[model samples]
Target: MADTEEMFLRAKHRTFSGLTEGSCPSTRSCGATAERLAERLAERLTEWLTEWLAEQQAERLTERLGERQAEQLTEWLAERLAEWLAERLAEWLTERLAERLAEWLTERLAEPLRDPEEAERQWTGPFCFIQAADPQLGLMKAWRIGDAVGGGDEWEEEVALTKQAVAGVNQLRPRPRFMVLCGDLVHAMPGTEFREAQERDLKEALSGTDPSIPLVFVSGNHDLDQVPTPSTVEQYCRAWGDDYFSFWVGGVLCLVLNSQLYFNGSACPQQKEAQEAWLEAQLSRASSAEPKPKHILVFQHIPLYVKSPDEQDEYFNLPQEARQSLMERFKRAGVTAVFSGHYHRNAGGCQDGLDMVVTSAIGCQLGDDTHGVRLVAVTADAVVHRYFSLEQLGQRGVNEELRKMLQAC
Candidate 1:
């Protein structure tokens, strides 16, 4: 165990130093490094596991198995060890790189206004809103990854976390004027029993929140089919009401878009055209409205980009062509900020004067991040935001319950 730990630490240091010396410029480069590191770690783990197995067999199991059988068993165990180590190392590296990318963006986006007038011009309303995304209620059960660890029923953890989040929102001293769930409310495919259960769990959780606080929903790839169809769209709408719509919350023009259309290969032409026309009209209206909205905030499921607006397309972000076009529109319309939540982690970056905030999930955590929601305060001169993890909000009990459940499983 000590040898394996030393090997991993050395490998991690070498990888990080190599990337730093090479001046790897983007998160994508870090991703490449992570891949290399995973491979290296897997090899080291395989070697360590093989040695340990051989030692055990020689010490006690020699009489139970023949030489050939022991060798085969050792080989099999080494193979599984390599695979598991690779996966775990990749996950760890991805989380580390994500944190670094977020830090880099914070430094890049920190602008100090020299002129008082310039600072005053960005003043927003006094109210605030909460942005939560990807509750993904039944995802744990559907994925079945937890089943192997005796945690097949781990979906309850998601429900508990969500419920805690809703309760936390209600308990805020100055309650948020509204809360926007930026899509993937449920994880099961459309029409699945798991999907229906997810919907029920989510609705029940939200119903416990303060009734005065409005809730807005957006469509995500998970909520609908992987590639949304007309029927899937209809089903989502029937359950959550208009997938795309606009509303006002304390002088803010909040436009909720159906991001599924942006990538849905199965979507009809009319669906695309209608959303485009509607978006243009809404932006135009906001641009010309009397006492023009203090800020234009866009909410969607997927972000335009993760680290930089020019970054290549990834599963976490919008497609390149659509991303560029929509960013142009957002720039033209003076959209202050855009919040999205499909990545299941918190990352933000500013491009062309618009801030893209991709919030962490409120249900299950994908990366090394904790389950939480972003509380954004739109003040007189700036938009301030912070993520509140469940533990920070007096919801550590949920974590305790989850630990017990997983232990029992």
Candidate 2:
């Protein structure tokens, strides 16, 4: 009979070696390894228990046990062995499966960047791009805001404003190389009719843009539900390829993030873990490239910090722990700036030699600011940006009263 230590070593060896093959065998048979292991374990446990029982009986009872007593002992030992084997096998399988899963995830997460050359080509020359956020196409409709003073549909006003923003991008002297809607392209709870309608309206508005200009969408909390989940993210991804990803424009690397993953009280642990892993890999690759990108700019829905990096937690910003850790990572990777939208107002500040620019919304007037989009021009040495109001883009439906009320807030 094998000793306990030897049996354990054999089990460990079989478990480790069989992991890659997706099967384990007990003894010389090729049938279901798990079942075989269970059977073998039960047999071994019964043998061990019988031997121990016999030794105890020899010491306590000088006379040999009767046939009935021996039969009862065998039955009890078999029952105990079955229960013990069942629990042990279950625990072993769970541990092994979890280990394999973790290993596979690590390998996948470490995969090299896809199409590095393509990313380089997209950003090979100095160019400009447009960033528009929080169009919230059905926001007014959801809020029950009435039609405009000019008697237009409440929802159409949002769609028209987005169209105006797109027109603004097309009119740029050298049309922007691309346009990115940072987040909140539509405003409605997920899995709703209004959400679908808002999305269609947004697509129509974007269709008016020059075909040559590329469009990218970032997922915002509003676009997903208030708290993003796998299903909500899938809905966003059906419209946009990925909620978070990186692209290049000349020497600049633009990273768009799903900030909802880091939003306080938003329980998206799997996404948060995966994004963190993917982001680390991307940053590491960029940092080690033969000729690193000259600048790294990030876009997302929520600001990492509002007034300062050390600012206390707020609904409008990322929680403090995540904020500080992300800032450190960005600083280490030499990120030049981060552009975000959620506060619905323009704000700018610099910390740790990095700039944080939060743009105003394109759908509604939240603060004293007008509804607008920011145009960013990337040069060899500097990045220049300016805000353009919808009115500046030939949309004369500016809501002066809303602006006044916002300012009084």
Residue 127 accuracy (lDDT) in model 2: 66
Give me the displacement of residue 186 in model 1, in angstroms. Answer: 0.6
lDDT, candidate 1, 203-268, per-residue tens? 776776665565677889877777888888888876776778776555567788988788764565
- Model 2 poorest ten-residue lDDT run: 13-22
Cα lDDT for residue 340, candidate 1: 95
Per-candidate alpha-carbon RMSD to the true structure = 27.0, 21.8
Give the whole-model CA lDDT for all candidates, comma-separated: 0.70, 0.68
Q: How do the predictions measure up, each by TM-score?
A: 0.64, 0.64
Q: What tens-digit string does per-residue lDDT give for candidate 2 at 1-409?
A: 1332232222221221211121222222322343445455555655676566656654444345666676676667656655675567555754564455444543443222233333353335556777878888766564555532222234787887888787766766555766777888877667865677767667777777765566767778888777888898887876655777776655567788999888843567788888999899988887986567877889899999878888889888899998988999999998888899888888868987788888898987668999898877676666666677877744432223222222331
For candidate 2, the lDDT comes to 0.68
Show model 1 residue runs off by greater than 4 Å: 1-125, 142-154, 395-409
- The most accurate candidate by lDDT is 1
Model 1: weakest 10-residue lDDT segment is 11-20
